[model samples]
Target: RPSRPASRRDDALYRKADFPWYGLDAAYTGPRWLMQAAVAGDGAVEHGSLGHGEEPSVRTEGGADKER
Candidate 1:
């Protein structure tokens, strides 16, 4: 089978905005397993959830919550 093309939404959004921005949502992927692993490793995956609290509290970098 052939691979799908990457979505242009992130690129477009970044270009449209001038400031340095970061995504607070889960990473995009074609496979369900990839998505599951990402969320499992990182608690701040934001899978249909608004998250626990404010920005600083939830804006952790990669799987920090799992450690704690």
Candidate 2:
């Protein structure tokens, strides 16, 4: 039997955008940058978020009010 193909990186699957991407606003400047993005089927930017400070660690919190 043949071996399975290697998986691609998460960033490799990200789509490119022509428009500028901003984090928060012009006044608030901190250690924030482009984390990831979500695009439509037509390759349009639907929505995304910016990462602040340090990289987040994965954790499971069993609560309705807890943030994902």
Candidate 3:
């Protein structure tokens, strides 16, 4: 446990932000510094944004909203 205790880490093991210029709500694969994968499970929402910018887009297997 951290010295300050883990609020989210205990809940979902997701680390806090301020780790980088941009980070996500959680740290799964890598550091939460890139645009979110656009999925559920308390993941980051935007890229290079201060929580005020647009969210990252994820392509569905159905190809309804495929990425360019």
Best by TM-score: 2
Residue-wise C-alpha lDDT for candidate 1, range 26-51, written one tens digit per residue: 44332211111112243333232111
- Please write out the lDDT profile of model 2 over residues 16-55, one tens digit for every residue: 5545555556665455544556778997666665566554
- lDDT of all predictions: 0.29, 0.49, 0.33
Model 3 weakest 10-residue run by lDDT: 30-39
Model 1: residues with Cα > 4 Å off, grouped in runs: 1-6, 22-68
Candidate 1: deviation at residue 51, Å?
13
TM-score of 3: 0.15
Q: In model 3, how many backbone clashes occur?
A: 0
The TM-score ranking, best first, is 2, 1, 3
Model 1 vs. true fold: TM: 0.21
Q: How high a TM-score does candidate 2 get?
A: 0.43
| Backbone clash numbers for all candidates listed | 0, 0, 0
- Residue range with the least summed lDDT across 10 consecutive positions in model 2: 1-10
The lDDT leader among the candidates is 2
Each prediction's RMSD over C-alphas, in Å, is: 15.3, 10.4, 12.4
